[model samples]
Target chain A: MRALSRETTALTLLLAPVTLFLAIFFLIPLGIMAVYSLLEPGLYGGVEWSFYHWNYGRILGWADGFIEEFDIVYLQVLGRSMGLAALTVISTLLICFPVAFWISRLPAKQKNFFIFLITLPFFTSMIVRLYAWVLILRDSGFANQLLEWLGLISEPLDLMFTGTAVIIGMVYIFIPFMFLPIYSSIEKLDMSLVQASQDLGASPFTTFRRIVLPSVMPGVIAGCILVFIPSLGNFVVPDLLGGARVVMIGNLVEQQFLYARNWPFGAALSMVIIAVMMLLMAVYLFRVVKADSNR
Target chain B: MNRSLGKTLLTGYGWLFFLFLYAPVALIVIYSFNANPINVMTWKGFTWDWYVGLFGGATTVSESSLYVDSTDQLLDALLTSLKVAFSATVIATVMGTCAALAMARYRFRFKGFYQALLFVPMVMPDIVLGIALLIFFVGAGISLGSTSIVIGHCTFLTSYVFIVVSARLAGMNPLVEAASADLGANEWVTFRRITLPLILPGVIGGALLSFIISMDDLVITYFISGVDSTTLPVYILSMIRRGIKPEINAIATLMLLFSIAIAAAGIYFKSRNTAQ
Candidate 1:
């Protein structure tokens, strides 16, 4: 009895705090946020205790003839966020394809150095990085001043506070997230397989399409999902670089809780974002499971 | 000749890719020493005046630029960040390491359930996580402050530490522990003399990484932070909302250097563990 009690005590001491802390802070909060989404947004702030689907209805554009007639405003922001995420993923893959291949081809010593250089920026804060673009892209900024000096354009272009600027910032931020995974798969790639394919008389483009592309598709998909997920919820980039002219789901959530003080509505917006993420995760999980079962 | 052509093409593409990656950071370093304090692009003259102005409270051009975020407040925010990072790192490291060890060394009931639940923090969007935590705190009647920020941080950070430490544990051979037990050592004794020393690298690496993440955090901290508990990143976000200033560039440059050093140290420790 004493030994059994002691073993239980040891296990409890080791695991209980983490379990309890997560339950209280993580699980409980997620549950509450979900619950709040189902409740009405109070007149001023806080929430109404009565059960309400109106918050979700407004965000999802299925508002049940309640006060507002199916506002598409929030839906547009969600679409914008999704569009930006898709663009960031595509652009990153295009830029990274050549780089990933090149890095994998490097001599062992140089390979580590190049990988380090790529990932070093990722360790820094996103806010600071986005601010750097502000310096470069702002009117009277570096690009404009240089163009003026070279007589490239008569007037400084309206570069900042635009959708183009937001995409540029997000792609810059996300490229590494795309690069490293693809590089990992590329590094581990068997060069002999490609050489064999070539010996079998396949052209370079054909070899890439039939062999190299198929092999690294997993990493490519992984990178896309990684970039897409964060960029979708990315509040900082659109808020700082894109300015008020651009409002994504992240910004709308921020306005609700921080600016508008509408907790219920904020919770609803959060649910929509979570739903999109969960849908993506379900697809990702399905793929992983299918691949594992096939193997 | 075809091979050479390919090599040159690749080299050119590689340089552009690297330049794209480092351009933003490189510009910050250059503009921190820029002459024009407000407009970071236009160079009036080279001066260490921003560096001076940061400490002594004066700009390169004028005494009162009005929009220059107070360096004193920035420093205060830095301290708050340091304090929060220190607390969250310590707590998360202990809980996460313990969980890592338990999950690795022992078989227990409900292990699969615990495993899935732990990773919820990593995959969940920060925006959703932040709002959820905020609503949670309000619902629970816990006043928002440094404590809330630390809680929010710990929620995610513990999982990160768990991952790092668990990777270390996974690679480690279980026979060492079996050998220690065969010599008549108790569980505590074996863990202390054998297991703990082996996994110390993971613990240290996880601690360092968690500290950096806690500091780098903005979205979670922003929602949970009170006026008195504004972290450096949160402060920077607010400053940018107001307007651009060169002092921010200077501070950002310093933070970049600081994070690189810490991350380099963490990688070193992580690599050292894998080598063994």
Candidate 2:
């Protein structure tokens, strides 16, 4: 009995600080945000204590017309954010998948070196990386300079502030997130299965479709989720690269808070992002649990 | 012949892949030394004027050429970043290490739930967390500043430390701890002598990682950092928004080196622990 009590005491001591800290800081803040999403916006910069559903109604196209007219623009921004995030995921997957395969086939020493090179950017300042894109995509930037020096065109391309620039920036910064998972999955792929499929007279494409795709699907899904979530709520890339042209949902949320001072509306926009994140997580969890049970 | 051709193609593609990953970074590093103050993209004679100017040293460059309004503001932001990262790292490391020990050693009810709860903060969107913290701080009457930033960082940083420490704890041999207990050492003594020493590398690595992350964190800090308490990244962001300058290139290059050095150290410790 005394030993059991001592064990309990030790467990309590170990867990108490994190639990309390997370409760006060993490859970409470999130809970307050959820509450604020439903609260009324004040005239100036703060929120009123009164209940208001129109903050969300503004985004969902059910605003009370008198005070707040529903704006399809918010919904369009949300859709654009998701669309861009999806494009980023697809582009990163396409770019990393073959590279991951190539790396997986390399000698172990070279493989580690390459992996280190890939992950090095992840450790660097995100702003610095984005700034690099700003330099490359600006009108008087390296891309234009290089093209002009090549005698390809006299005119500079309108690259910066385009959706293409935003996607490129997102893909550049998020390569490691997509690469690591796909590389690990490719490393675990069974060469014997591929050989067997090929031996059965399957074409290379057929064998890959039959054997490799299924094996790497988990990693692809995981990489997509990792890339997509950050991309979905990414304000910095769109703000820096997209400028005033390609506004994403994250920018809308930022404007609401910083410029508009509509805290409740900003909170509402954030909740939309949270909703999408939770849904995706739920699907991923369900798939994982199912996979585990099948195994 | 087809297989050999495919192999060559893949090899070439791999090199291109790496080039894509690294070219932008290389461009920034090379251009940092370029003397073109008007257009940073154009190649000019190499000079360290930008780097020299960053440290408040006199440069041949005219005052109109320099974009930064004040070096004092830049230094103040750096100081704020260092302060926030240090305090956040210390608090997060302790809490995370403790939680990791409890979770790894104890088989308790709701263990899965607790683990999931910890992960939510990590996977939650940074914007959501930033706004949530902002609302919470303002509503709770807690002033937003370094204190709030530290608190905000610890919320997620503890989870990172927890993961790193837990991985270390997982790899450890339980028999040594049992042996210490059997040799009449109490739980506390066994933990101090056996577990703590074993996990020291992981703890240090976790601390370094959290420190780097805290220093680099912008989105959350942007929302929560009140007037006059901006960190380095937030300050640099404002600079970039105002205009591109040669000095930013110098600052970025320095930041890149600083982060790479700390990250390399952290990875060294991690790899050493795993190798053991």
Candidate 3:
């Protein structure tokens, strides 16, 4: 009984610091945001005392039976956010899987080098890389110059500040993130099973579909989540590459709190995004746990 | 023959993927040497102009040149970034290691709850955390500056440190602890001598991870950083918005090389470990 009490004391004492730090700095701020979402906008900087659901109503376009009062602009923004995130997840998965599979197939001595190369770019500051892409994709940039030099086009292509540019940037930077997880999964796969399937007269495609894909599905799901969540909330690519032409959920939330001074609305939008993220986490954890149970 | 053909195709595909990956970073490194006083597209003859300009060396600027930062301001921003990163990493690594010990060594009630709470900071959107912290600080009447930046960073970084250290702890040999107890060492003494030493590598790895994350962080630092506390990324971000100069490219290349050297060392160690 005494030893158990001592253990509990040690645990409490040890856990206290992080718990307190997180509570004060992280949890309290989020708690404040939760409350702020319901409160009306302040005259200047803070939220007013009165309760208001108008902020969320405005975001979700809940018209109080008045058709003209409705605006689905932010909802569409939310849709765009989802669409872009899904696009990033799917494309990154498709591209990185082949890359991961290739790396996994390499001779054992060389495999680490290939994996390391994929992730090295992720260590560099993204702002610098994106700026470099601007140098490549801008008017009179490398792409345009090359095209013109090749006699493929008479004029410089206007590629910068386009949605395509944002997607391109997202895919490029997110490749390692998607690749590493998938690579780790495939690297650990029972290759003998793959060989067995091949030796049983199964076609390559049939072998891959039955053995390879199922074995690496965990990594694929993980890669998809890793890419999808950040892409959904990404403000940098859209802000820098998309310029003013495109706006995602992150950008809109930033605008509200900073420029528009609509704290409640911004808080509401964030809460919604946070809710969506929480739901995704729950789904992912549930799926992973179920997979673990089956195994 | 078919297997060899397949291997060749896979190697080609790997090269293509890598080319796509490294092109932008390589462009920055290459162009940093170009004496393109104007746009980077117009590649002037190779010169040490930009690197010299990044240092305190004198540069002859034409009338048409955009604004340039002196080494003083750029160094100030770099120092601030280093300071914030170091301070945040220390705090997160210390507190996180302690909490990780608790989780690893004891069976506590509401363990999952605390774990989830820590993870929320990691997975939550930076924008959400940025604005949320902004409003929180503003409401709390805490002035936005270096101190707030440290706290803001610690909030999210603690989670990462916790994850890294706890993973190490979970894999640790339990018999070592039993041996320490059998030897009649007190709890604190055993922890100091055995557990802490055992987890030191994890602590260092977590610290490095935290340091990089803190340095790379822009959005949270941007929202919270005051006029005097602008970090390197923030300064560079502002510069890019106005216009990027070749000197900025030089600085970026240097930063890239620094990180690349560190990554190379990490990869060497990682591969050695895997081989063992």
In model 2, pairs of residues that clash are none
Q: Give me the candidate number with maximum DockQ.
A: 2
Better of 2 and 3 by TM-score: 2
Q: Specify the highest-lDDT model's number.
A: 2
Candidate 2 ranges beyond 4 A from true positions: none
Compared with the true structure, what per-residue lDDT tens digits does model 2 show for residues A33-114? 8988999998898888999999988999889788789999989999999999999999999999999999999999999889
lDDT of 1: 0.86
Model 1 clash pairs are none
Per-residue lDDT tens digits for candidate 1, residues B31-131, read: 88878766677776787777777676554467655344456787788999999999999999999999998788667798998898888798788988998
Clashing pairs in 3: none
Q: Estimate each model's TM-score.
A: 0.96, 0.98, 0.95
Q: Which CAPRI quality tier does the interface of model 2 achieve?
A: high
Of 2 and 3, the candidate ahead on DockQ is 2
Q: Cα lDDT for residue A49, model 2? A: 94
List ranges where model 3 is wrong by over 4 Å. Answer: A64-69, B63-66, B265-276
Candidate number 1, chain A TM-score: 0.94
